[model samples]
Target: MKTLLSTIFSLLILAVPFFAQGQQTLLLVGGGQRPQEALKEWVKANPAKEPKVLIITWASANKKQAYETSIQADLREIGVRQFLFSQDITNSFEKNEFVNNLSQATHIFFSGGSQTLIMNILNSDPQLMNQLQHAYWKNNIPVAGTSAGTAVQAELMITGDTKNLEYGLGFLPKTVIDQHFFKRGREDRLRSFMKQAPGNFTGIGVDEDGSILFKRDPKTKEFNSTVLGSKNIMVIGPEINQFRQEKILRPTLLCSQLF
Candidate 1:
């Protein structure tokens, strides 16, 4: 796993020159409610320089205008003005339109709901998926997601119900995120993922009000994570060699209040 992480880190450094901008940022929020500190940081990042924002609600079951309106009002309170809303993508035109629209967005956020729904929609349209990749990878737009929205950002996504882990949008290729961590006892599923993951992937378990902030260094190609909100962030990685009693710990998960 360490070797895999090293290889990926090296690759990211090499690929830095290909991107139009410098650094990429991601904010992953745990399910339920957003913490005040996380919300404050998100709002502060919303400068006039990057005014355009896209909010995706496809994961949300309540795809009504009222729900969107409520979200808009909350964002507006934080000084956000320009906005684009996406509830569903059915036709080719909408899909194409979404791809084109991403070019103008400075920030993109996915709302909370079912991760499966978001994956199904994104996978159904290859163009949309490609466009999103370009927007974040090359364009340097910051992407944020909550709940199921956070889950889909990993390459290996938890199905929520099943013990299996399937493909996700994978914005954070090296990490897998789970929401409502301690409250719902989802650590076991994450352990299952670590056991079955194809490559070196870090498992991040977030409490209902917790969030994980990720930033990539353009020069060194290193990634740093900071834990925010109340509660704690759980990190699970490859088993380490411990020569205490010759007892090999099968699963090694660490819990910390901060990253």
Candidate 2:
């Protein structure tokens, strides 16, 4: 643990010196299907640190050893040549090991499964999270999560409750993300869910075998999104209101207008 902390601190210091010189590239992949090719392409193109992967078990949302093992192997085959995902995660020792591994990785790949569980792990670890925050702001290491992982990236995760959206460890503050969009008929529920939204969050729903990769332009400080393996990444923004009014306008709605 001591060794890990020292290492994380050293990375933080390095990021500062580089900032005075220039910016670093950050990638955020909303999980789904296979993202290995994209990762390889990104690393091959970028001159930053070697692309390393972190397959968080927290998102796997499972305690079954067999299930976790399967996820690990699947990720390895996908080009996570250097990674922290391994074996069964059933205790703090394993958790610490994962955190320490995250300290060095340039990329974070969240596997599909449970969002709440992952959020809890992050919430439970103060020291580990401290390292993550430092690594994020100082180094601008790219962060990506798929399915439940993607859900947690939103300002708040909808913890299986339509009445009340649960609190999430916010990464992207704009909106909540839903995976397997069209096939699952999430439109109605998502539409209703947005009605209770506290702010203007872009509701992003992706289909199976689909994903979103965000390009963090070091020079522009803007995160532009690109979709892969599918068509029409649904964006529930202000146009939604125009969509509603253009068809059937209604009153007594309390929420931010989305396009």
Best by TM-score: 1
Q: Compute the lDDT of residue 81 as modeled in candidate 1.
A: 83
TM-score of each: 0.79, 0.69
Off by over 4 Å in 1: 1-21, 43-47, 64-67, 241-259
Q: Encode model 1's per-residue lDDT on 1-259: one tens digit a residue.
A: 1111100111132223354356677778887666545545665553546466788888877754654675566667656788887888888777766776676777888888788988888888777777788787777778888888899888788876677888887777756678888889877767767777744456778777667666677667665555665556666763444211111111123322221
Superposed model 2: Cα runs more than 4 Å off: 1-32, 35-37, 41-50, 63-80, 86-92, 218-220, 238-259
lDDT of each: 0.67, 0.52
- TM-score of candidate 2 on Cα atoms, chains taken together: 0.69
Summing lDDT over every window of 10 consecutive residues in candidate 1, give the lowest-scoring window: 1-10
